[model samples]
Target: PEGSSLQACDEAARKLTEMILKEDGVASISTYVGESSPRFVLVIDPVQPRNNYAQLVVVAKDLKSRKNLEKKIKVLVEEQLPNVQSYSRSIPLGPPTPYPVMIRVSAPTDALAKEYAGKLKQVMLENKNVTMVRYDWMEKAPAVRVELDDDKLRQMGLTRKTVASALYAEISGYSISQYYEGDQAIDIVFRLEPKDHQSISDLGTMSIPTAKGAVQLNQVAYLSYENEDGMIWRRNLLPTITVNAGIADGVTGNDVTNQIMEASKEMRNKLPAGVTIEIGGPSEKSEDSLRSLLGPVPAMLVIMLILLMTMLKDVRKVIIVVCTAPLGIVGVILGLFLFNTPLGIMAEIGALALIGTIIRNSTVLVDQIDQHLAQGMPRLKAVTESVIVRFRPIMLTALTTVLGLIPMFPSDFWRGLAIAISCGLTVATLITLIVMPVIYCLIFNVGNEEK
Candidate 1:
C-alpha cells in the first residue's frame, strides 16, 4: 500500500473520518489530502507529500476528552481498518516522538537495510510489551524497467535521447511548445491515448518516430515489469529503515526498549558487515536533554565548595556539609516510591536544587557551631547547642518549602520536581539538624576535648 495512488489514500482517509466523527468528544477534524498538515505546533514534525499518504488533525473538547478519544480512536482504526496502516496518539506535552519505541537499522544498500529491518521488526514483535510493530518503508510496488538496445538503436538510426523522448511522450505527456491566450500560456503536449498505452504490453508496442519514420519501441528496446521499493528512507545518503512500535499500558518506553535490546544481543552479533542498529524515539530525546542539563553540574559543585570554604574557613566543617548533601538521596528514592512518580528530568532538577538547600541548612548549623566554639564554649556544648538552636529554623524552612510545592503536585510537568524537592528537603533537614551535628562532633573530637 505504500505506493497506492492518491485516490486510494483519499478514500481511506474519508472512511476513517466517518468513523472518527461518530466518536464522542471529537470537536472537529481537518483533513489534508496527498500530504501531512502544515506545522501548527512545535512538537509536530510533518511528513513530506506522497500520493499514498494522508493526514488528519483531530480536535477534542478538553484534556479529559482528548484522553478518552485517543484510546477509542486507536481501537477503532485497528479493528475496523485492518488493511490500512494507521497511528493515533495525543500531542505530547514535551518532546514529540513518532512512536514510543523506534529502532533504526541502516546499511550500505536498501535491500540489506530492509532485510535487517524485517529481522528487527520480528524481534520487537516477539516481545509481549511491544505492539503495532511496523517499518516506514512498506512492500515494493510493481514498476516498469526499460533497457534500450544500443546496437539496434544505432542500426535504426536512433539516439538514446530520441528514444527516451519518444517513450516519455507515449507513456506520459511531453510538453513540446507553449500556446498563449488571454495573458495565460499553456504547454502543448503530446501523449498516446489512454487506451493505447494503458498496460505494460502496450508500452512495448508503442511507436517511436525516427529520421527514417516510425518504429515500434520493442524493435530497439526491452520492457520488463519488476518490483521496486515504493519509498526509500536514507540517512547521510546510506539506506536506513526505522521499525517503530507502541508499548503496552503501564510500561514505560525505556523499559520495553531495554528489554528488546537485551533480547537482541544474538541478533546484533549476527548482523551483516556495514549494518548498524540503534534505539531512538523518547529514550534518545530524554538522554540528549539530560546530558545538556547535567553539563554544568561539576562547575556548580566546585563553585559551591569554594563558597563553603570561604564562609566556614575550615576543611573539617566543609567535609561534614558536603558529605551530608548526598544523604537526601534516601528521601528522593522514598518520595518517588511513595508518590508513584518517575525520576524524570524534572525530578533530577529538583534533586539538584535539593543539594543547594541541604548545603545551606548544613552550613548554617556548622557556622553556628563555629561561632559557639569561638565564644569559648566547650566543644561538646558547641555541638549540642548548635543542634538545639538550628532545629526549629531548619524544620520551619523545610516545612514552608514542602507546603509551597503542594500546588505543583497536580501538574504533569512539574510534579516530579515538586516531589523531589519536597521529599528530599524534608529528609535533608533531618540530616542537617541531627546528622550534621553528630558528624561535626565526631570529626572535632568533642567528647575527648578537655571540658
Candidate 2:
C-alpha cells in the first residue's frame, strides 16, 4: 500500500502467499520479496532489486485444476485487496522469460517511460487473461543518500577523497594495503569492526579524519534515506520501462497478446509523437519464430518449382506430381489435430520430409505410365497397369515407414514429427497409387487419345 522496502515487501509477499495457498488446486506457492528468482538451478548476471517489489507464484496440481485455482485466487485477491495492483498469466508457449507479457514502453525520459509503463500495466491488469504486473524501473528503492559538503570538508581540513574513502571503509570494506606470508602476497582488508558496523544509523556517529582530530560523518556530509529509482535502463540510447505480467490459465500467449493489442489500440492515438510501445516476451518471440519459418517458404516453393521443372522437363507433368504432395499435408494437419499437437518446427520439418516421400510415390507411378506409353500400349491401359503395378510398392513403403516411426509416436518431443510423417505418408501413398495416374492422363491427354 505504501512505498517499497524489503521488510514491507516480504510481509506483503507472505500475506499474498497465505491468500493464494488457500485455493483448492494450488500445490505450491513461491513468494518473491523484491524480484528474486524462484528457480535454484542457475542464475546468470543478477541485478539488485531496489523497491518493495514482490510476487506470489501459485502453481496448481494440473491443467484443469490450474485454471480454477487461478480464477479463485483472482477473486480472493480482488475481494480482499482491490486497491493493490496485480497481473496474472497462463502457461507460456515459448521458453521462459522474466515475464510472459512484457510491455516495453520507450520514451524520451525514464519518468515518461515509467508513466506510460504504469498506464500500460493498469491496462494489462484490466484484462482477465493477464496477471503479475510489475515494473522495476519505476521502483524507488529505500536507500541512504550521502553527499559531501564542500565547505564542511574544507573547514574540517579534510579532502573529499579522504572523507569518501573513510565512509566506504566504514561500511563496505576495501583494501588498506597488503602483507606477505612467504612468497604469496596477501592484501590486508579493512573496515569498521563488528560492533561499530552493526546498524545503518551508526553512520551518523561514524568518524572521519581531519587535520586536528576526527569529526563525525554527519558534520561533513548530508545524510538521509531518500526514495530513488537508482537503476537507469537504456535501450537504443532511449529510456525504456518494461512492464511485465503473467497470463491466466485456459488462455494462450496469443490470446493475451491479441487482447492487449485491442485494449491498447486507443493508447496509440493518445501517445506522444516520439513515444512508442512494443509488446515483447514469449508472445513476440513466438510470432518471430513463426514468421521466420514462413518467411523462407516462398523461396523454398520457388526452388522446388524450378527443380521440378528442370527434372520433369514438362510444366504439366511437374504440376501433376507436385500437386500430390498436398495430399499428404491434409493428413499432416489432421494427425496433429487428433493428437492435440502444435504445428511447431518439428512438424514443419516432418512436412518437408513428407513432401519428398509423396513426390517419390507420384514419380514412380508417372514413370511407369511413361514407360508403358513408350511401348505403344493404349493410354487407358497404361494408366490401369501403372496403378496396379505401383500400388504394392507404394503401400508397402508407407506401411513400413509408418511402423518404423510408430515407436516415436508417444513421445512429446517427437510426437508431431512421427504423426506428420506416418500419417502423411499413408495418405499420400494412396493418392499417388489411385489418384496420380488419373492426374497424369488428364495433364498429358494420354489416356483419352483413342476416345
Badly placed stretches (over 4 Å) of model 2 are: 1-96, 175-189, 193-202, 249-251, 287-303, 428-442, 445-451
| TM-score leader | 1
**CA RMSD for every model?**
3.4, 6.1
lDDT of each: 0.86, 0.76
On the 0 to 100 scale, the lDDT of residue 193 in model 1 is 87
lDDT (Cα, tens digit) per residue for candidate 2, span 1-451: 4354467667666777887776677888777677755454342223355445666666789878987876676677688767556655454333656666777889998778888887888788899886567774676656787888999788888998897788788777898798999999898888878678555568778988777989998887878777876677888989988877777655656567678878999986799967999877766877787688778888877898888778778888888888888888888888888877767667877987887778877777778878898999888898899888878877988899999999998775688789999987877787667778778778778746857
List runs of model 1 lying over 4 Å from the truth.
Answer: 165-197, 205-209, 212-216, 448-451
Could you tell me every candidate's TM-score relative to the true structure?
Answer: 0.89, 0.71
lDDT of 1 by residue, 331-373 (tens): 9989999998877888988988888888888888888888898
